[model samples]
Target: MLEPILVAARGRIIAGVLGGAAGVVVIVLLVLALTPRAGGGTVLVPDETPAPRWAPPADPPVAAVTPGPYGIAGLAEPAWVARTAKATGIPRRALAAYAGAAMTKASAMPACGLSWTTLAGIGRVESDHGRHGGSTIGADGTATPPIFGPALDGDGVARIPDSDQGAIDGDTKADRAVGPMQLIPQTWRNWHTDANADGREDPQNIDDAVMASANYLCRASTGLDTEAGWRRAITSYNDATTYIDAVARAAEGYRTAADR
Candidate 1:
């Protein structure tokens, strides 16, 4: 699964993100950005246990994804972020990216059945919400110093020759996965986003990385509300049964924790 990309912020502020309320003022110029009966996911094949446990997360009323104070990151309900952050222990900043990305997708791909909790579940598994190795998610939603997976050299994982030529992964010898979503250079090229409206589609940016992950899964599977669909979509993201189940458990936990 992640062995290929299984590896996975913040930073210092990005150069373009002006200090203070200025960035909020700039967001007004930006634009907006699955599933099952099992709740929210994408793909094929039904689980032995279906529908109930994997049901789509509780439907929170999402604000319209319009120009906002923090680009798409502002779309999540402030109250929801506060309460859910306490319940799930997700950093408010990263939680916003997860929730806001789902809301942005809602208007664009309502049929996809994606949910913020599902995204959080992936975040927990991917990079502990970008907290791996003590990294932080900047206010602008970028991961500092960036994150990279172990080199894929066929030692125990798939061996992929250099693709980005040391650009994205910073490795000219092997193609290491980059970003919180752990997308390899080749995969990142296929599904990239600029949800933060920074004009750059950087995988290191959680806003971009999370949205890109949603794009990849939504495109991979028709829907993710059912066990079959969720499993399929996760499998596409990481072709391992263990990985699929891990995401399911983590996502389900977030959904349950938030609802409480």
Candidate 2:
């Protein structure tokens, strides 16, 4: 009777243990079923926020200007004169010499009566004082020099001939402007002369080109002889409003620089 009772008690303990294990298993299953897993959504984190803009520094350094009479007798401030001389790449000393020569020549043609300021302005507008390197249009197509500058297509991309004969061969499509003043081939042919005494007439030469422009404007037909005539001549020289205005402004500037 005692042995049977002990065996029955051991079976009951085993059943309790099994029941507890089943409860634990069920709890674990419930947790797994209710708890969610990670999904395929993106979590974006920005690296940095933008900063507000600030004002620029005040009292910027001014450029050094050379002192001289730019093209006029002596009106330009030293700094302004220096800048113009440097811009033209014409040495201050050489520019002075040229100014002297120009004054002498200008004196003889008082009837032409244009101010140095105006002449300087014309130079500024015409070719920006030989800064522009131009190309020729030819029969094959538009021919550009390897080093033509940004002003080439001021209004539009000018088509030129690729062949050497384009300009000479009567291809209206092939002829493009040339020289410091951006003179058309026909115009250049008319005005080109040895202004610099270099034996040959070359429009690319700044001194020659500038002198030629002066001559063309001061010529009898252009009527630069009178103030009104000079105005008309300038208008014909450049048809743009801004260009005309700039020439006037530049001429004043040049005159101021030259006088000093």
Candidate 3:
């Protein structure tokens, strides 16, 4: 399973002002804490732009779609989904998965404060919302051909032996991160879910992967409504400071785009 590391370690905060970010500051970095593990999330440096402490992304709508896993896609209204997808440049199917996952998390764990924008940030960094490698997200939320990360063979990446016998990633020699969230086979096997309620839980399906991501994230951090908490949560997901910062930037960009 994806372990949540509570990083209270020491690190440098590279401050930079995002042009056209419209008053957003990122703080709470977990540098070199719990990195190089099996699964991790995947930051920037520029002239310093004076800004206040980091602000977590605004909460997304928590309107319920229905009572079952199948309803996850309907968590957001059609028109709103379309507009927000267009605004944020996120695919409609991917946006639905991310938004629905957030809404579901909001209802399931109200205090976690998991935002769809943050999920989008992850999807963007992980697999481009299941659109990476020329693969497309189907209406059912499954990524065609699926997505897999580079082999973890100790070649410029974390070396993890083949854990699933290639059952999940199709690579028996070494384990590879799979699906939109880029979860390793070991992690997926431990935390996979059936968000689509299709009777079978899959890592390739955007809905399932997103919900699994939400569950893991919420479990990693009790609350993500604050800068320090959000940073810790992202750091737990991926120990690299760059990964945390990149997710923050992507989340801020999504929120900014949605408002515009």
Candidate 4:
């Protein structure tokens, strides 16, 4: 009887010990399964997946065009014209009038290569475009006589005769500094060619003036496109340094504007 009771007690104690050991094994397994894995060379663990990558769009390209010869002047704005006139120190209205006159005359005679800007500059220097009125006397008792004769022709047109005698001594005071371009009687004689279909040489006529100016420039210019040639041509138009500078500046402005 004593031996049987002892055996039963031993069996109960062994079973309890086995059950406790199984529970501990389950707890350890749960902890390991729930824990997160870290990134490493040998870890072989899953990490936050990287966001899907995408490419950016590109911008469109700009196209450029080549311009024609003397295109700059064609693009000349009013502001540019005004600015150029201001830079030249010439009156705005006077410059415009002169430019317009030259343009009209040259266009009428397309063969004339004289640029309107060059002619305008010349007009400014010569007779101040007939504004000076051939010189005048001051308020004082001094007679400021005419440096040259009249600017109007017989028909009130600007006229300069081709004859040497006429140049030296013309009957009409109006024959003095012919047209807006101011061609003198003698100078006009040298440069005159019947550009227009007119029967005789007429320097005072705007048509004649424009053609003469063009011819003179071409003759004086060794190379029309060159800076040096421009300088020589402008200087020949009037021997004054001021006149040359003014014309050169105006020409440069014209070329730049036309090119644009």
Candidate 5:
């Protein structure tokens, strides 16, 4: 009798344990059903906004060119200048100045691989090829209204204090970038050249500015034919990555447009 009772008890215990386990499983299922799913049955994604793209300015008709002391014989306003100006939207006069400067630099340093497109790229970024603020390029490769950057009085821009004593930029309080290339007074003093052959190194003249910019870039690296050299040269001009990218894009645009 005792054995039968013990057997019955063992059966009850097993059933109880199974019942408890079933209760736990039911509770887990209920909890899972009550829990909220991620996104509420919807998928989520990160932002997919693209970076900003920079474009060259409109190709406006430039006035006729007049022979100047700085004019090079073989470099005299090529047909490609007008063609590229018309195609890439760069000013004809600006294109001529850039091309002449690049050609001059090539003659001086044949291994530099300096191209008009690169100078044009810098010009576009510096001051829209001297067309920024309604300024126009003259036959002598000078900006009509003259382009000047904001005063570098330790503001958001550089804090370079008056390096030229109000002579080049006319600001004694702080040094401001002058001309189409946006060159500081000190840089102009160091790299200034008289591409116009007028016996004076004037930053206001596009011929001089373009030549100076080209020389500076060529001196920065061995050759700009490779991306590393090109990047180094441009970074020496301006360390900002955005500025470099904008210049590269503008240069590529000019190249592609000119090819077409």
Candidate 6:
């Protein structure tokens, strides 16, 4: 009987040990199910899209002004002149002269579409609005220190002998292009006008130069409104393909910048 009792006690101890082992296995499985896997676990991600980059607002279009005189007693400048000058990096006085010349031309010759930007283009190409070579445009529209082109003595340039006799170009031997617009003495004499209404036709004066340019451009067969007209007018100014291209590029730049 004692042997049987010992055997029964051994069986009960073995069963208790097996039950504890089974309980540990179940607890391990529960822990594994509650815990997250390395990369297979579900995560709460916010569904949102990123904002786009910002851009500056577009500028409003400038209104056109009625045609009028561009002299000292000329019409007042529209508010857009200042704004366009600031936008295009051009000086206010130069911009005003260009705009004033265009308006004056419009009044004098209504058929011509002489925009201020075109004049500005020519000014930039010619003498940088009279600021070329350390020179500046004075308050009276005169280029300070004066501006003169190389003497046209047939030395790889047009061979035009002195026409003014040292009166205008100050060169008694050969004629040199004078002023910011680079006008030959004869050409200045032919198309000269008192743009400033100061009773004198001065080539060094911005107003005089601008008015002369407008007159010459308008005299072209086409009126500067169409592409052909524009090209023809610009050619009339310099008569060179390179010059026309440069003026066109500058004018387009000014126009596009003003719109911005």
Q: Taking the tens digit of each residue's C-alpha lDDT, what string does model 3 give over 142-178?
A: 8887877667666544567888999998899987777
Q: Which lDDT values do the candidates have, in the order given?
A: 0.65, 0.36, 0.68, 0.37, 0.60, 0.59
Steric clash pairs (candidate 3): 42-243
TM-score of each: 0.77, 0.48, 0.78, 0.40, 0.72, 0.71
Name the candidate, 4 or 5, with the larger TM-score value: 5
lDDT per residue (tens digit) for residues 1-260 in model 4:
00001111111111111132222110000000111224310111222533112111111111113311111221223454476556654444344333443343344543333455565545443433323333322221111233333433433332434345455335434334444354555546556655343455555434345456565555554443345555655545544343344445444444454344
What's model 1's overall lDDT?
0.65
lDDT value, residue 179 of candidate 4: 46
Q: Which parts of model 2 are misplaced by more than 4 Å?
A: 1-108, 133-173, 220-227
Error of 4 at 5 (Å): 99
Report the candidate with higher lDDT, 2 versus 3: 3
Q: Rank the candidates by lDDT, best first.
A: 3, 1, 5, 6, 4, 2
Worst 10 residues of 4 by lDDT: 25-34
* Model 3 CA lDDT for position 36: 26
* Model 6: CA > 4 A from native: 1-78
lDDT of 1 by residue, 1-260 (tens): 12232221101101122234323110000000011223222223234554333535655535643535556788877777888899888898898889888887787997777888778777776777776555678989888768777676667555677878899888999877677766677767666779888788998989998998887667666567666777666655654443555567667877788887
- State the lDDT of candidate 2 residue by residue for 150-187, as single tens digits: 22122233333323343422334443344444444444
Mind giving the per-residue lDDT tens digits that candidate 6 earns over 151-219? 667654446688789888889998766776767677677568878777889988888988877776676
For candidate 5, write residues 1-260 as lDDT tens digits: 00101111111111111132122110000000111235321111222433123323222222236543456412644565667779989887787788777767666896777777788887876667776555778877787687666676654343567768899887899766778776667667667888877687878788888887787778765467666777777666654544555567768778778777
Off by over 4 Å in 4: 1-114, 127-163, 167-177, 252-260
Choose the strongest candidate by TM-score: 3
The clash tally of candidate 5 reads 1
Clashes of 6: 0
After TM-score superposition, the amount by which residue 171's alpha carbon in candidate 4 deviates from its true location, in angstroms, is: 5.5
The alpha-carbon deviation from the true structure for residue 242 of candidate 5, after best TM-score superposition, in angstroms, is 0.6
Model 6's TM-score against the true structure: 0.71
